[model samples]
Target: MFSRLFDALQGGSGVGAAVRRRQVDAEVPNFAEADDVRAAFFSSALQHAKSSYDAERDGYVWGRTLRPSYALQLHPLNTVQTYTQKKEFVWVGLTAGPWFVGVVVLQFNYFAAFSVSLYNVESEESWRATSRVPLPGPWLGGQWVPNEKGEFGPTSAGHRVEFSAPLSTHRARLCFAGRSVQVDATGVVAQQLPNGKSAGAQRYEVHAVATLPEEFLGVVFPLGPRRAALVSKVAAAPLQSPLKLRLGGTEWSGDGYLSMDYTRGLLRRETRWHWASATAPAGYGFHLSEGAYDVDNKSVENTFYAGGRAVLLETRVEFHKVTAAAKVWTLTGDGIQLRFRHADAHDAALHVGVVKTDLYHAWGTFDGSIRVEGAMYKFDRVAGVLEDHYALW
Candidate 1:
């Protein structure tokens, strides 16, 4: 059944040709136009848009014309009519005391992958594990249910996500092999901006810091058609949360930094990006990304959040690896500079004929400064992750 499904999705002719055609049709909007469009489109929608699900569109539709928010809203669109173009996931990162734990649950049409990692901040000792479940059905795998307000959130059984009134507390759990990992958090909205407004949908961005409980256990864990030609739109926020973690009979607790990434889209066959986020001080957050998937360099994702405000920067970031081993590297960008020396790293290469992924993830620190709002915020050492990823599916 899996083989046949793969053949059905991958066997068609002119897939590459179709992708090229779409690339031309979907030229990214110019950076100069992005700000004006976002302000005009999102401000109106946020004020007057009524949120309602469009079964025909397979996601929430907002505003007078009933614009689809699949591209912008922080909700899941699992019921998209184009089954092959749908991909969705929720990623959470927790850093507290001497430990950092990362958890994720991802669903592509052909399979679902769950991963958990525990890292020690001081020593850089890390343990990571992953499990893959082949999914060969029209329903795909898990569920992503929206709130009463039609906002994108997660809820699942066995492994579940929940929320409290006014969307204050966001909670999640993953259970496998009689062990569990859980997150109990509360988010404070910092800044909200327009992500982009397109003919198909209107999108916006939000920055927040989610506060988490000191400690919890269980473990669990994209774009384009052609099985790889889609783009996964993302809304990510750096977090100010506390954490208490228990894994493999060991426990640790401390004030931590967390980040949430909510994504939905179809991805292209080949993709690359640079991503890093950190809790530089007790209440300040730093995040930066440069990726092929972004509409352009002006993506709101490239900014810093401090004191509940965001400072958008004009950044040109480059990564220079100092060694062939790729364990030590320097990342530099306009108004930003950092060095990452991987204490421990994870490398995975998976290929199944037409599908391929090569991913390297390193947890490290940034020793530099970021200029925000014409002011420089310096850091001798700050905790974060550096990732080099490539995928063709």
Candidate 2:
């Protein structure tokens, strides 16, 4: 099956065959416009394209797919991310220097309901937003303004009758009003961003904290009364990301989330692997080799969407942390360092049904104070490393 799809993605050209085409708009980057929030225009565009992949296309066995970032599927979405800020001064330690925090509160369904906002923690004090950009499918949130109530309701038409937005290095100030929540985002955690010019692609620091008022806790997505029913499978708060890593005096935190998983499936198969070896201004360099694979054999895909960019790596990554390993059971490759110190290690585990599983996860946080990558580190109780021939999800 993988051989077939791999061959298809490699060269197969047909209506049903997967076709990879990256159409980067040739227009000059409007640094002046999208430069600030990176929006060349004041509008946050919604992008929509018709394809045979719709659910209506029906049954497929060897035909599974994955979606990375929702920002990529926006209708008339802005080619570049643009941020507009309304400042409310907030004091900082000053000793730590100025801090940057951005917030984007997305209001779906409502003419102006919610927005995903990014606020520079040290730069501003508070901001309120109302109203939305005139777009199709979902409403677009440009710059957040100060407001509580605008309009709330389901969309009239579109593939996604509901609304949801991504957040990175941003926070939210919201509370339920009667039935809807007000977008008064002020308590969101600070999001981190990658410097970009280095070896890997994603770089953002954000701590996600949600305040679900009593009324909203039972509520599900999709604004309509019939659709917004209580969810069946309840989980605990703070569902840590399945992946994150740190190395060589630098730390990399990852959260490859998929917002709209129709069937609530966790079978991730499609994704790519990246091997990055970068040197800082100082000669001290580091190597970052990471990627998502169907380690669990979910027959689905694992991916991430940051800054409105979608990155899909081929599933089944091979990691040879250790030079000599007899074989990799569930692990494609292994850490050459049989056992190391995970001094700053954190645990992110997932429990499914009657059995508990494990996932290959380890990382060290580096602050550029010393040689960190490959530096000897130890790990505590690990999580989610499923040992199977391929995948068992």
The model with the greatest lDDT is 1
Q: Write the per-residue lDDT of candidate 2 for residues 150-231, one digit (tens) a residue.
A: 1111110111112233442233332222212222232222222333121322223333322111110011111111111111
When summed lDDT is taken over every stretch of 10 residues in candidate 2, the lowest stretch is: 86-95
Compared with the true structure, all predictions reach lDDT values of 0.45, 0.21
lDDT of 1 by residue, 154-239 (tens): 21113233222222122234221111224543222111112322122111111223432121110010111112121111112234
* lDDT at residue 186 of model 1 (Cα atoms): 23
lDDT of 1: 0.45
The TM-score of candidate 1 is 0.62
Model 1 residue runs over 4 Å out of place are 1-83, 136-142, 148-242, 295-300
lDDT, candidate 2, at 306: 24
Off by over 4 Å in 2: 1-53, 59-317, 322-341, 347-353, 365-393
How high a TM-score does candidate 2 get? 0.23
